[model samples]
Structures are given as structure tokens and as C-alpha cells.
Target: MASTILVTGGTGTLGRHVVPLLRGAGCSVRVLSRRERPDEDGVVYVTGDLRENAGVAAAVAGCATVLHLAGGPKGDDEATAHLARAAAEAQVKHLVYISVIGADRVPLAWLRSKLAAERAVADSGVPWTTLRAAQFHDLTLAMVEKMAKLPVVPSPGGLRLQPVDAREVAERLVELTLGAPAGLVPDLAGPRVYDLAELSRGYLRARGKRRPLMPVRIPGKAGRAYRAGANLTLEGATLGERTWEDFLSERVA
Candidate 1:
């Protein structure tokens, strides 16, 4: 029988891609979802909420591996800790995690939460692998789309992003989940980097709309961190194939 792998956040953006690939690789997947869901082909759903530490042990039971992907703006550390504790108790063989590139250096509250989540997985007794990736194209697109709604979009100076394809990130994650536990593999980023202004301009062009961009400075230490490119990984990182332009073309109407 194929080993059953547990996937948290299996219905999310990256999870949507990872779960299918895992299934294709002949692994029976058990997804932990907050809402109750019926079983599907080669995959089963276990109702659970990592945040509240509810239904976690049952979800981790009998699984050879646990892919920790459930995350939010906050409480990521707590949620991941909850899952880690359950996995440790279950003696799950492999624990895999997905994190952002600047989790440690960004100086943002949310990034701190992500960094803490990474620590939670590392401290878990189960063997683990964590992959830090750049901002997803989908997320970047949403930001730009929302900004374009205003009469004048505020473009933060020195705010640059290497937006990666979520599918590519998913592919790498599945490879890590299946393979031996390798701690902190190389970071993944997009082929090209674009500033906030450039990204917003691209979005406007794609939508056949125009908006004046107002150059704005990000205030406080967070701004300083961003100005220093703390959120970027320019070297020793695995670059994804899809560019921001490629994603915009396909996603933007």
C-alpha cells in the first residue's frame, strides 16, 4: 500500500498544486481542512484546524509524512507549533514546511510569525525540511490589482519583489516532501525582480487601464529593511522559470 501523506492547507493556493502532484506520484493524500470535505479520488479529507489545535492528532495518525502549508497573516507560529506537537507524538517520519524568503530579515510582524513557524518545525522531533520561497505571483497580482483601483496608486520606493510561480514552488515542495529530510534547502525566487512601480505599471498595461503612480516612502524600520532588500534573495537561490510578466499575461484580462 502507498504511504499516506498528510497535507495541511491542502486546499490553498500552493496546496492546490502540491496535492495533485503528490497524488500523481502514487501517494495517498490525506488533507487536513477546517471545513468538512468528502473524500475524492486517491485523496481523503480530515476535518481539522491547525490554529485551534483541533483534530490534529487524528489527522497526523498513520501518515508517513506531514506537509505543513496552512498559514495566515498571524498565528502561523502557533498553528505550526500545534501541528508539530501532533506530528512528534505520532512519530511521523518527515515534516515539510513552506516559508517566505524574508521571514527572518523582513522585520515585519507577519514575517516574524513565519520565522517562528519555521522554528516550530525545526524543533519538532520529526525529521524536517523547510523551503523558503519568494512572493507568489498570485499574491503580487492581487496587491497590484487592488492598488490599481485607486485614482493614484502609491508605489513604495525601493520596494522590489521577485514574484515566483506557485506551481513551480509546489513542484519543489513535493520533491522535498518525498525525499529525505534536508534542513533549509536553497531559497526559491523568480527569474526577474521588479519594483513596486514596475509591477503596478505592468498590471495597468495588462488591464488596458492607466493610473498615476505616486512615489511613497515606507516609514519606520520596516521601510529601512525593505530599502535594504531584506525581502529578496539575489544569490544562492533557485530561480523559478515563470516571470511576473508571464503570470500577468495569463492572469490579467
Candidate 2:
């Protein structure tokens, strides 16, 4: 494969970590973003919005590999389809994607979008690989921080999370991007799992704050899925080294 690689969402949490590592690997990195950014530190910035199918073909042109990570609360399915189609037209060699762990099992709109995005890439005629990873420490921190802001935090009963370090996920993604496409490899999760209560308490303790956590049930199929641990990968998965507590100590402390 050529050394030039295009990374979508190269400004987000995981992308921030992945770009530097790719640069260190002696690969020329091209980042596509909605807004224009000046090129710096040997990285090229291309202005494009994947959601609107704008500048996508130009972004994928002449790049051997495309590391797709751009996502949002919605429209990921459509955006990924746009990217995949463009990549196929450009005759790109490989397309690597990052998806959430419960994408296939969770009864949520966002997860459904992710699953559709996976399908778009798989059927795009470009060789592809997909990694289903747990929530990142950064995202978990954001969640708990918001919860701690409330006078009484509503802890959803049976809702658990296995938060992994974004850097570790980044490293693994870089390894996959450089190598051959392996369709749907094992899930990647944190070293340990923590329930919603435990996660909230950890955040509260880290920030030297206290809040009463009221147990609230998530209604319907989504609730049942959470209670059944459908979001978890207990077996046949790759586990990260960092724990939720490890993240709290460094970030919150």
C-alpha cells in the first residue's frame, strides 16, 4: 500500500490520537474536515463535509487507504455511504472503520446507524475492516461530568459501560489500517466493566462532589438489552489496559 492515508474525523477524540501515531509511522496523513485548517507539522488538511457528499471524491483521490472515524448522533449511515462510494470510485485499496461495541446488539438509533455504516463500507467494493470498540474514557468522562452537574443524578438501572482508553484504540486502528483488511475482528473493551452507579460515584468522588443517585429504569427493548448485558463483550474480545478509575485519576484528579 502507498504511504499516503486519508483519515476522516481527524479532529475528534480518537482521531487526535490516531493522526500523530500515523505520522510517526512515516505515513503521509490527509485529514478531511468541515472547516478549513492550515497544514501543520507535515500533515495536510483538506476541507470537506462527508455528510453532504462534498469534496469527498477529492479527499479520497490518490490515497491508498481511508481510515473512517467521522460520526455523530445521527446520519452516520448516510455519511459513511457517501465516503464508501467515493472511495470505491477512486479505487482506494482499503477502508477501515471504527464502530461502537453494541452496534449490532443495542436497540438504539445511533447504534443502528453505525451498523448501516458498516454495511456501506463492506459492500463498497473496497477492501475494508471494522473495529467495534467500547466507549472511550473521554466520552465517559463527559457523561459523568454532565450527571454530576445535576442535583440528583438519575442512574439508569443495569446500564453498564466498559470504557477504554482512546489512545489504545488508536494504536490498534493504526495497526489495522497499515495491514490487510480483516473483516469484523474481535470487539475491543476495557479491562473491567462498571455499572452506571459505579461510574457516577467514581466521577463524583474524583471531583470531590456528592450527589444522590436515583435508580431509574430504561423502558422497552433498549432497557431489556442493557439488563441482559447485550452491550458487553465478555468473551472473545480484545481488552484494553486502562480502567475507568485509571482515567478518572489522570483526568479528574
Candidate 3:
């Protein structure tokens, strides 16, 4: 019998790629969504919301592993806690969590929520692995587009980022699911770091547009931490093969 794995947020950005990869690896995948899709090869769509304990429990029943990737913009901590509790009740053999790189050091509210979620998973008493990855390259491009529409792109000055590929991050998570559930693993990053404005410029250039880039100095602990490079991966991390330039080319071409 193939090992059953339940992937929360299985229709999401990363999940779309992950679902196919796990299926190719011969794992029976059950995706938790708000609505079910028709049966497909190696895939089962289960409808449920992570915010509901009963729903989460039902979705996770009889699964050998659970990949907790469903997170909200602000209430992720609460939602993740509920999922962790449900995973514990279901006696899941392994729980794999996808988190951000600066979750521990950054002072952003979203990052704080992710940290709380990580803690909840650690305390859930299930064998688990938490994989922290740098900002996704797609996220960076989205940011650029949003900022470019504004009068100016407001960002902390002197901030650096190691934007990683979402596909690479998904690959690492799949690898973790097939292996022993270790504790926190090394952060995953891109091959190089780039400044925010430079990255923004790269995005504009890719689309054959030019926009005035203005770097703003944000106040508070979050701004200071960003300027201090708190989001960068230190040592013992995996570097992705695709560079920001390569990512832009792939998208534009």
C-alpha cells in the first residue's frame, strides 16, 4: 500500500507543484481544500477548512503524514494551532511545516505568526520537520508590481534579500516527507542576495518598463531588523540553482 499523505493548502502556489511531485514519487496524496475536485491519478481532493478542528481531523484521518502549509495573512498562528492539535489527535506519523527564513529574527506580524505556528508544531509531540525558506521569487515580483503602481515603492533602505524559487522549496519539502522527521532543518536560499531596489529594477526591466525606484526608510524594530540583514540564511543551508535573472528570463520568455 502506498503511504497516504495529506497536504493542506494543496491548491495553493507551492501546493500546485508539490502535489504533482509527490504523485510522481508514488505517494497517495489527499489534498484538503474548501471544495473537492474530481478524482485524478494519484490524487484525492478532500474538502475541509483548517480553521475547523473537526474538518481538519476528518481530512487527516488514516494519513501516514500531514504537510501543514495552510496559513493566513494575519491569523495563521491560530489556524496552525488548530491544525497541529488535529494532527496530534489523528496520530499523524510525520508533520512537515513550511515556514519563512526570517521567522525567528524578523519582527513583522506575519513572521511572528509563523513563529508561533512553528512552536505549536514542535509542542504537538508528533515526529515533525520544519523547513524555513527565503522569500519566493514570485513573491518578489508581485511586490514589485504592487509597489510600482504606487507613487513610490516604500521599503526599508539597505535591506538585502535572498529570494528563492518556489519550485526548489517545494522539492525540499517533498524530500523531507519521504525521510525521517528531523527537527528544524537548514534554511533554503537562492545562490545570491540582491538589494530590494535592484530586484525591483530587474522586474521592471523584464517587463520592458521603467519605473522610478524610491527607497523609503521604515521606522520600528521590523525596519531595523530588515536593514540589518536578519532575513539572510547563515550557514548549513541549501542554495537553489535558479538565479533571480534566470527566474525573470523564464517568466518573460
- Highest-scoring model, TM-score: 1
Model 3, which residues run further than 4 Å from truth? 151-155
Root-mean-square deviation (CA) per prediction: 0.6, 1.0, 1.4
Screening candidate 1 with a backbone cut-off below 3 angstroms (N, C-alpha, C), the clashing residue pairs are none
lDDT of each: 0.95, 0.94, 0.87
Task: Provide the clash count, candidate 1.
Answer: 0
Clashing pairs in 3: none
Indicate whether candidate 1 or candidate 3 has the larger TM-score.
1
What are the TM-scores, per candidate, against the unseen true structure?
Answer: 0.99, 0.98, 0.95
Cα lDDT over the full model 1: 0.95
lDDT tens digits by residue: candidate 1, 176-202: 999999999999999999999999999
Instruction: State the displacement of the C-alpha of residue 111, model 2, in Å, after optimal TM-score superposition.
Output: 0.8
How well does candidate 2 score on lDDT at residue 238?
Answer: 100
Candidate 1 vs candidate 2: the TM-score winner is: 1
Sequence-dependent TM-score of model 1: 0.99
